[model samples]
Every structure is written in structure tokens, then in C-alpha cells.
Target: MTALLLIDIQSGLQETVYYGTERSNPQAEENCHKILEVFRNKDLPVFHVMHNSTNPASPLYPGKKGNAFHPLVQPIDEEPIFQKTVNSAFIGTNLEIAMISRNITHLVIVGLTIEHCISTSVRMAANLGFHVTLISDATAAFDKIGYDGIRYSAEVIHQTELANLKDEFAQIQDTVTFLTELDN
Candidate 1:
């Protein structure tokens, strides 16, 4: 069975000041919502992963509202949620066990920043033997400042992560193509 794994689509990610001033893929959340809608309508399994940052100043701190799921992809009552503090959803969470128990071998992934939780989870999922399809348009990335003082644009970080994961970790697809394939 296939499942949608949405990682950290939380309100905290919207605060660019916390992550970066420039964020790539302004339509990422909208694309994520589109995929979520289709997944729900089709009665497919959907798993939500929330991040509770240990950093007190972080927007995703446990007591902060930013830790809440974004309104766009809020989970319904029956949908299971796995909250974690780490980058990979598989660690410190039963997400892998749950999917394994459900016989879910294929994963359709979408979520917040591509270079962080998204990349980590994708690689880990592949390493664990699940077939993964990461939706390119349904994920975003923040601009990063290199240790050498070079600044990388958000688009570069996003595309690089996708390129790194493509074929090796996951089959990367855009929202429209993924949705079309899902319908077919």
C-alpha cells in the first residue's frame, strides 16, 4: 500500500525570519494541500509529522502556536500524527513501525523545507526499503548561508536537495504530474 507522508507542515515554517529571509516555492503549501485533498478523497493513508523543536526560541517550541500544523494541511480526527524533535520522522517515532504494520511499502512525500526534515526523511525511507516519491513542487527550502560566508538561494538549496535525492532516494515528481498519475 502507498501512504502520504507529510513532514512538518507547521505554522512555524511560515515565519521566514526564523528560517531565512528568502524562501523558495511560495506555492509549496498550496501544492501540499492539493495533494492532501486528493489523498483524502481517494481514501489513502495520510500520516502527519509535527516537529517540536527543543530550542526554546524556535517557533516550533512545544508551547508555541507555531508548533501547530499549518491550516492548509490540518489532520482530521482519524488521521494519525507522529510528533518528533529530530530531522528524520523514523527516529524517535513509530512511523516506520506503523507503516510496516499497515503493509505500506510506498510513500508519497511532501512537506516543509527540502534540505532539512524532507531530505533526511527521504533518505531514511529509501534506506529502510520503502519506495518513495517526493513531490518537488510540494516542498520548499530556505536560503542558506554557507560556513564560508557564501549565501545560497532558496531555489538552489531546494533544487540541489531534489537532485541529490532523485532516483537514489526517491522518484521526484511535481504536484501536477503526481496528482495526474494518482488519478490514473
Candidate 2:
């Protein structure tokens, strides 16, 4: 069965400066919330991945308020939440085992900073033989400085990651497209 994996939709990501100077897809959280609602309503399996930074000063540190999941996509009691300290949600967490135990063959991924945790998790999920569809619009990206000191915009990074992952790692779909799939 298909499952929804909301990866790292944490409050710390809202503090854009903490990640990068600029970020793309500001509506990603809301889109994630929309997808979450649909999964809950349909009684589909839903899993939440939370990033808990080991760095004490980081906003996602365990003791910080910013470590919490964003209000928009907060998990209900029944939804299992997997906490991770690394880029791929499967690493250092029981996420893969949980999905496997439940016989979840497909994963729909959405969440913050597409270039980081989202990308890594998508790639890992695909490698582990899960049918993966990444909600492109529901995952954002931050600007990065190239080796030559050129600054790339968040949109460029976002698009590049999506393109790199397309076909090779996972199928890419926008929030609207995923919602349409649910309807039919």
C-alpha cells in the first residue's frame, strides 16, 4: 500500500536564515498539510520524519522550541513519527523497518529543504525498492554557493535537485498532480 512520508516539516526551517540566505517554495508546508489531510481522511498510512539536530545551538535541537513540527502539518496521535539526526530519514532511525513491517511499498514524500533531507530520503527510499513519488511543490530548497563562489538561487537548486532525482531516483509530481491522482 501507499504511504505518506512528511519529512522534516519542522518549525526551525521557517527561520530561513538558519538554513540559507534564500529559500524557495514558501507554500511547501501548506501543500504538505493538504496532502496529510487527504491521507488522514482516507485512512491511509502516514509517517512523519522529524530532524533533530545534534548541534545544541541549532534551531532544531531537541530542547529548542523550533524543534517542533510546524503547526500546519503536526501529527495526530496515531500517526507514527520518526526522528532522525541525519539527511536520510532511514539512517539512525527505524523508518525503513516501520514501513517494511507495515508492508508499505510506495512512499509519497513531502517536506522542507528539498536539496537536503528530502532528496536524500527520496533517493534512499527508491534504493530500498519503495515506489517513490516526490511532491515537488511541497518541498523547498535553499540557495547554495558553488565551488567557484557563484551564488545560485533557491529556485535553481530546487529545480536542479528535482531534475537530478527524476526517473533515476523517484518520479516527481507537484502537489496538484498528486491531489488529482487521489481523486481518480
For each candidate in the order shown, give its overall lDDT on alpha carbons.
0.95, 0.93
Candidate 1 overall Cα lDDT vs. reference?
0.95
TM-score for candidate 2, please give it.
0.98
Model 1: which residue pairs collide?
none
lDDT agreement of model 2 with the native: 0.93
Q: Mark the regions of model 2 whose C-alpha exceeds 4 Å error after superposition.
A: none
Best-performing candidate as measured by lDDT: 1
Error of 2 at 45 (Å): 0.3
TM-scores for candidates 1 onward, in order: 0.99, 0.98
lDDT per residue (tens digit) for residues 1-184 in model 2? 9999999999999887887898999999989999999999999999999999999988999989999999999899999999999999999999899999999999999998789999999999999999999999999998999999999999999999999999999999999998998889
lDDT of 1 by residue, 1-184 (tens): 9999999999989899999879999999999999999999999999999999999999999989999999999999989999999999999999999999999999999998799999999999999999999999999999999999999999999999999999999999999999898899
